[model samples]
Target: MRKLLTLKHWKNTFAFIYKLLMSKEVAVRDKLLFLIPVIVYWVVPDVLPLIPIDDIAFTMIIAEWFAARMGRKYNIS
Candidate 1:
C-alpha cells in the first residue's frame, strides 16, 4: 500500500502498461480485456454513480491489476 503512494511506482506501472499495450505478442483480445472496461468507465461514470472513487483512481487501480495479470500470463518482467 505504501508503494502505491510513490511517484516511481506509478511511473513504472504506466511504463509497463504502455509496453504491454504496444507489444504485438499480446493478443488484441487480451488487450481489450484491459481496455474495454476502462473506456466504459471513463465514458460512462454514471453507470456506477454510487462509487466515490475518481476516474483516474479507477484507471490506476485497473492498470495495476492488468499489469500484474498480463505480466504473469505473458511472462513479461
Candidate 2:
C-alpha cells in the first residue's frame, strides 16, 4: 500500500485516468466498461427519468463518436 503512494505510482495512476478519459471507447461504450450508472438510473427513476436518461446517453454516444473521428483525423505523431 505504501508503494502505491510513490510519485511513480501516482504518475501511472494519472496516466491511466488520462487515457481512460480521452478514450472514445470508454466515453461511448463505458456502459460496457462500467454498468454502475445504468443500474443506478434503473434502480432510481426519480434521480433520472428514462427519457432524460436516454437523451443524455444517446447524446454522449454521438459526441464520443464525433470526438473519436476527429481525433483520428487530426492525430499527431
Candidate 3:
C-alpha cells in the first residue's frame, strides 16, 4: 500500500519504536507482543507453496501497528 511505503510513515514508525524502546511508559506485556513475531519468524519454517510473502513485510506491518498504538497510548508525536 502507498500509505505504508511513504517516507513519512517510516519516520513516524521508527520514531515510535525508538521512543518505546527508550521510555518506560509502555507495559512489559505489550512489549512482549513484538517478540512473538520475531520468535515465529526465526523458529518456524519459512516454506509455503501457496503463500508467497516475506517475513520482513509482515514484520514491517506489525511494526507500523505497534508504533501507531504506542503513539496513541502515550500521546507522543
Candidate 4:
C-alpha cells in the first residue's frame, strides 16, 4: 500500500543518516563519546538485543582506528 512505500523511504533515510553519522569525518573520540550513549540507550531498554559482543567490540575498534587515524591515540593501559 501507499503507507508501505512511505515507511520504506523513511527506512532508507534513516540508514543514510546512520551512515553519515559513522562517516570518517566524525572523529574517533567523538564517535566513542557518541556511541556510548547510543549503546547504553539501545542496551538498557532490553530491546534490540540483536547487537552482538563482536559487533560492539568491532565498532569500538573502528572508532579507535579512526582516533589513531585522526592522530588522537588512546592508551587504555
* Ten contiguous residues with the weakest lDDT in model 1: 43-52
Question: Which ranges in model 4 have alpha carbons more than 4 Å from their true place?
Answer: 1-6, 46-77
Q: Write the per-residue lDDT of candidate 1 for residues 1-77, one digit (tens) a residue.
A: 99999999999999999999999989999899999989998877677687777889999999999999999999998
Question: Residue 28 CA error for candidate 2 (Å)?
Answer: 5.6
List lDDT for all candidates, in order: 0.93, 0.49, 0.74, 0.51
TM-score, each model? 0.89, 0.35, 0.71, 0.34
Q: Candidate 3 on 21-76: residue-level lDDT in tens?
A: 67788788777777687567654545443445567777787888888787788776
Backbone clashes per model, in order? 0, 0, 0, 0
lDDT of 1 at 16: 97
lDDT for 44 (candidate 4) = 53
| Candidate 2 structure quality by residue, lDDT tens digits, 1-61 | 6754476855554454446546665544542333455445556766656555564454344
Error of 4 at 32 (Å): 3.2
lDDT of 2 at 49: 62
Candidate that scores best on TM-score:
1
Between the candidate structures 1 and 2, which one is better when assessed by TM-score? 1
In model 1, the runs with Cα more than 4 Å from the true position are 46-50
Better of 3 and 4 by lDDT: 3
